[model samples]
Target: MIPHDRPVMAEADIAAAAGMELHTWRRRHGSDFRARVPVVNPGERLRLYDQAQAAAFLEGRPIPPAPPAGEPHPDDLLSTDEVAAALGTDASTVRAYASTGYLPHGTELHGRRYWPRHVVQARIDAGDQRHHPERTGAGRQPGDPRNTAPRGRRTEARVQEVAAELARAEGEALPALTADELAQRYAVSRRTGERLLAAAREYLQQTGRGA
Candidate 1:
């Protein structure tokens, strides 16, 4: 059995714990895995299974009943895939939003990006999702301001501020911020963030603080 340090297991973890080949397990169980196990993150790219329940199933015992379903804790850290699931979209779209500043910057952990549950919830509340039907309402005129492409409110000061912030994250030994992360932090367009990131890196190099 795999070590029980985590409360959940990815598909590979489940197979490892069960002493089965990963491909074999996937081939035999992937389709019905969710149906038979207590899935912790349904409809998400990084689906997790309740470790105890999965172990029980693997051991040929009746799985224990899952707890009542409830909302994720506000402080809960969610992966990009989890956020996409909450937003009723796909991971690529979520990444695109992050890159475009539609979504805010998230924390980086174990080489993956994550956001607090509250952040994802706030986005849902905003009703500004790119895929929302309301975003494509019937047009009455060609000269409508709504037809104008969105632009970033840019300034020299903001660029400097973003550069400083990037330096701070680096000083703290955090993962280097990506353009998407910068856009999320400043609520600017991806192109703007890319420019800011470049300037930040230049600043860091000049200051001998580049990571």
Candidate 2:
């Protein structure tokens, strides 16, 4: 009986040894035997995890793509539809805003009117507060007599002078002046200078002298 048990135990040991040998062979040769074994290095695994996280975070969201570099800023110019969308209104409301001076006046380009995007955005940020009676402080209302129109008239005259100077410098072509040059000449802020230049350009166009 002891001899019989020894042979059975020997058989079990042989089976265990065969299993170990098979595992070792698989480790050495199974890689080449497979058609394609996915090998994910640490960097690739990390990237995959990051992508999964980002995908999860962006789930159920429809985000717009970022604008390309050097592309014109959306705040620089707006289409009628864009203005309407921003204002939570329709295109007709935007047109009315422009006509009523609530929004900046726009120019017709290629038969489509486009507002200066910054101006419209500024007005919107101001809560469409232009000419709001409730927002008016104790200070005199716009066009009040206490405020001298002469100052504005003087500014207008100065604008025309600047325009003439520009015309003289570049002939009737009326070359565009840099913001710094306009500010130095007109004693105005750079922003004010830009507005003045825009107004002057409008004047030139109306008078058929913009050539």
The model with the greatest lDDT is 1
Clashes of each: 1, 0
RMSD (Cα, Å) of candidate 1? 11.5
Q: Report lDDT (Cα) of residue 42, candidate 2.
A: 25
Please give the RMSD to the true structure for each candidate, in Å.
11.5, 30.0
* Candidate 1 residue-wise lDDT, 1-211, digit = tens: 1112336777767777767766778777767776788566665434567777888877888889876655547767788767777887655456556655677877763235678787888889987645333334533124322223253423444455556657645433335668897665444589978988788677678877665
TM-score of 1: 0.43
TM-score, structure 2 vs. true? 0.28
Which clashing pairs does model 2 show?
A: none
Q: State model 1's lDDT.
A: 0.63
Clashing pairs in 1: 105-184
Query: Model 2, range 125-203, lDDT digits (tens) per residue?
Result: 7864333324246443453222433566656765664555454334312245666766654445789778767777776
